[model samples]
Target: MGLLAFKDAVHLVSRTGLGAEWDMIKQLEGRSQEDAVNWVLHSAASGLRPTPRMTPWLKLEPMRLNDMKTRNSAWSISQREGKLLQAWWVEQMLATHTPFIERMTLFWHNHFTSSIQKTLQPSLLYQQNLLLRRHATGNFAELLRAMARDPAMLVYLDGYQNTKSQPNENFARELLELFTIGRGQYRESDVKAAAKAFTGWGVDNNTGKFIIRPEEHASDSVTFLGKTGRFTGDDIIKILLEHPRTAERLTEKFWLEFVSNRPDPALVSVWAQQLRKSHYDIQRFMRTLLTSEPFWALQNRGTLVKSPVELVIGTLRTLPYPRESTQELLNLCRLLGQELFDPPNVKGWSGGEHWISTQTLLVRNAYLSKLSRGDLNDKSAAGVKLPNASEEQLVEWLLPVKPLQPLPTTPGARRLVRSLLLDPAFQVS
Candidate 1:
């Protein structure tokens, strides 16, 4: 509850928002933790870039379903539009005043786990992106409910094909294992029951909206999580929300995301209880998390590996360097193992140490080295103006921990920053 020092403010902003954005950290530096956290929770701009034009699902669907040649053409169109969609989001992240919203939207996009590649419909994915943003920090229960019928997700997980006679368990299985509870909490039978509950939930071919084909729905009673009822998809979601593990699983994910890769079990329990008590209110949960003791712990600093989006977008936002073009940014994201709207699998990006394999580290270093080139030389031909700060202040601004590699023996501001940028520590928060 005391005023946050510069280091603490930097930690809060860097971990919660995009990067260690100087102005944001400075704004929160002398404020109470409550005030700073409130500012983060509420201070988001409402504007968004207009979505790029996409072939509507109605037109695109028939092309894919028609024949091999048409399907090949549809695939090519999907590839093109998907890149445009990726560029749209990349542009938003670079230009938005609401970086936290974009960050959380990315977070939920990972959790929900739909992909342009699997769905083959960039237009539907765009709509899914909008849905994720709307409920990014609003309510977990509502978001879960909305995601159940999300057109992209339906296509990605084959929920649209889940008829009463032939239940597809892909979406149901992920809903239990990844979304609601961890794997051990549910039985195979529970997945079957859940799939039955979701039967007849299909997207309309003409309009691409969620449509319930009641005739295809199973009306038989199915037991789920120790309860017996003839359940609908909404009914199944309601039951999952009431399960204790649902909140705990979500809390565990939050701990991994904001606290560290390794969650303290005792703290996870307490936060899970608090989240459940708040009726899954995400902003309230985040307020508790940001104000919690563990969030400010010294040992937790730099324990997280930065994702590709964080590294690319965060660097551009924090530094005075010119940004890569949107297309190149998309390529970096793909090369760095996190192509937007194209997560590797349902598990999404394995983010922790997985973000820093030997190959990716080389790419990361090469990108940073290229970005900082010439800007550090005498006369500074790139004309980038780094903050006028001392070596210690610059270190604090650029790194979450002491530079793993020794600082440069030479004495220049840009040189010091370039050294910190290449340090192993910069790959982390």
Candidate 2:
């Protein structure tokens, strides 16, 4: 309950933020855990960079049906604009003062998964990014309601095609299985009921906003989770929120993300209860997770693998080396299998051990090796100067665990730092 130790400070920063930023870790090193967690919860980066220019949905939607040439043209335009959008976010991550906000925004983007590949409208994907960031640390209940109305989500999950005559269960199925309550907790009838409730929710082509056509809505009463009513989409969401498994499912995800890959059922239940008690407040739940004993347990350190963005973006943020160009970073993300705006599928990245496949580990090491080479040899260099700290401090700073390979028997802080950067330990948190 006293001031945090240096290692604990590093653990908190690395897990919550992009990386263990030296100055950030130093600021919290002597502060109490409560104070440190509060600082992280409150300090979010303000104002995103201006969005990259994108072709509107109306202009692009017609091209797909017009002719083969126009359809090809549309694909080319989307490909171009999508790369620009990816670069825009990479730039922000590189320069942001508050990395924690960006990290959380990325977290929710995965949670409410939508992709440029499926949407084909970079502009709408951009809008969805904004919505996620707005509620990144706010109430989950509000976020779920808003996401049901989100234009990008409407397209990605075929919610716009849902109608009274023929209901599409794509969105409703994922909403129950992946987003809330998880699998096996809900029945197929619940999926059908939820889909019926969401019918007539579509996007306005002209202005790119949500629209509801009353004629397309189902008026028939349906029973959902033992409740019979002619329910609307919002009503369905409300019923789900009332379900006990909703908060607990979310807690399991947070555990896998922040703690170890394996979530302890007992702790997850307690955290979920606390989360529900707080009315699904995200910041309140994070404060609990960060301060919990399991989070600070030594055995849990470095148990989770770092995602591509964390490995690539985080290293540049923490080290003195010059960052790769935004395009290059985007390529690295794709190769590492964490493409920013284009998640592989609805489930998003598997993360954890999935981040460190044999091929990916090679790419990861090569990137660190190249980064460390720049100005690592000379402490007096004008660019990329290694920090003038003891070998022990450098090891403590760079890795959450002991170096997998032996430390350099030769004595130089720069040499030791380079060795630690490529260490297997560095691959984890």
lDDT, candidates in the order shown = 0.91, 0.89
Residue 69, model 1: lDDT of 99
Residue pairs in candidate 2 whose N, alpha carbon or C atoms collide under 3 angstroms: none
List TM-score per model, in order: 0.98, 0.98
Clashing residue pair totals per candidate (backbone < 3 A): 0, 0
In candidate 2, what are the lDDT values of residues 27-57, reduced to their tens digit?
Answer: 9999999999999999846778887999998
Backbone clash tally (model 1)? 0
lDDT of 1 by residue, 187-244 (tens): 9999999999999999998999999999989999999988999999999999888888
Candidate 1: where is the Cα deviation over 4 Å?
379-383
Q: Candidate 2: list runs displaced more than 4 Å.
A: 374-376
